[model samples]
Target: MTDILIRNIDDDDLRHIDALAAELGISRSELLRRETKDLARRHALQQVTLDDIRRSVDLAQGVLDEDLMKQAWG
Candidate 1:
């Protein structure tokens, strides 16, 4: 992997990051990697199956109940 350096992190931010690393029993670098992976996963979910994402447009127009989506699509 390539190294990416981030400068100008605040003291409080560093402390919080360190605390998270300690909480998860990881090194600070591993903690940062996990954090980035989590952030990417959160955004990536939008691109993955969420039951019925195509229904989102119909949802805005009051066309479906989310609870019923599985039965409808299944």
Candidate 2:
């Protein structure tokens, strides 16, 4: 496994992490690792949702344009 060093964390934030770690019965390092992984997972899921929305918009636009063309010709 690779090692990572983070610097300049706020005192309040460190305190919060310590409290959460104690509640979960885990070390601060483990809590940070889990939180980081969760954040990455959520960000990836959000990107997938955005892509789906873009595809839906493109599909809807095509359908709307086809309907408009038919109405104009009819």
Candidate 3:
């Protein structure tokens, strides 16, 4: 596997990474590797901000409802 080094990481940023790794019960390197891969995969997708999501959801307002319940359940 290729190695990537992130330089000049701030103390707080490192602390956050350490905390996240502890939370996930993994080494910081492992957590960073998994996160990096996930980010790489996600980077290829269309990026949507919170505003975009809100707008899309607003556009879809009241669209999904109990209408499909009959077909799904009965």
Structural similarity to truth (TM-score) of each candidate: 0.59, 0.62, 0.58
- The clash tally of candidate 1 reads 0
Poorest stretch of ten by lDDT in candidate 2: 58-67
Residue 40's lDDT within candidate 2 is 88
What does the lDDT come to for candidate 1? 0.82
Tens digits of per-residue lDDT, candidate 1, 1-74, equal 87889999999999999998999999999989878889999998767565576676556653366757766677
Which 10 consecutive residues of model 3 have the lowest summed lDDT? 62-71
lDDT of candidate model 3 versus the reference = 0.87
By TM-score, the better pick of 1 and 3 is: 1
Question: Candidate 3 — which pairs collide?
Answer: none
CA lDDT for candidate 2: 0.88
* Residue 35 shift from truth in candidate 3, angstroms: 0.9
Residue pairs in candidate 1 whose N, alpha carbon or C atoms collide under 3 angstroms: none
Top candidate, metric lDDT = 2
Output candidate 2 Cα RMSD.
Answer: 6.4
- What value does the lDDT take at residue 47 in candidate 1? 75
RMSD in Å for model 1? 6.7
How well is each residue in 1-71 modelled by candidate 3, as lDDT tens digits?
99878889999999999999999999999999998889988996667799889999997865566776556
Give per-residue lDDT, candidate 3, residue 56: 93
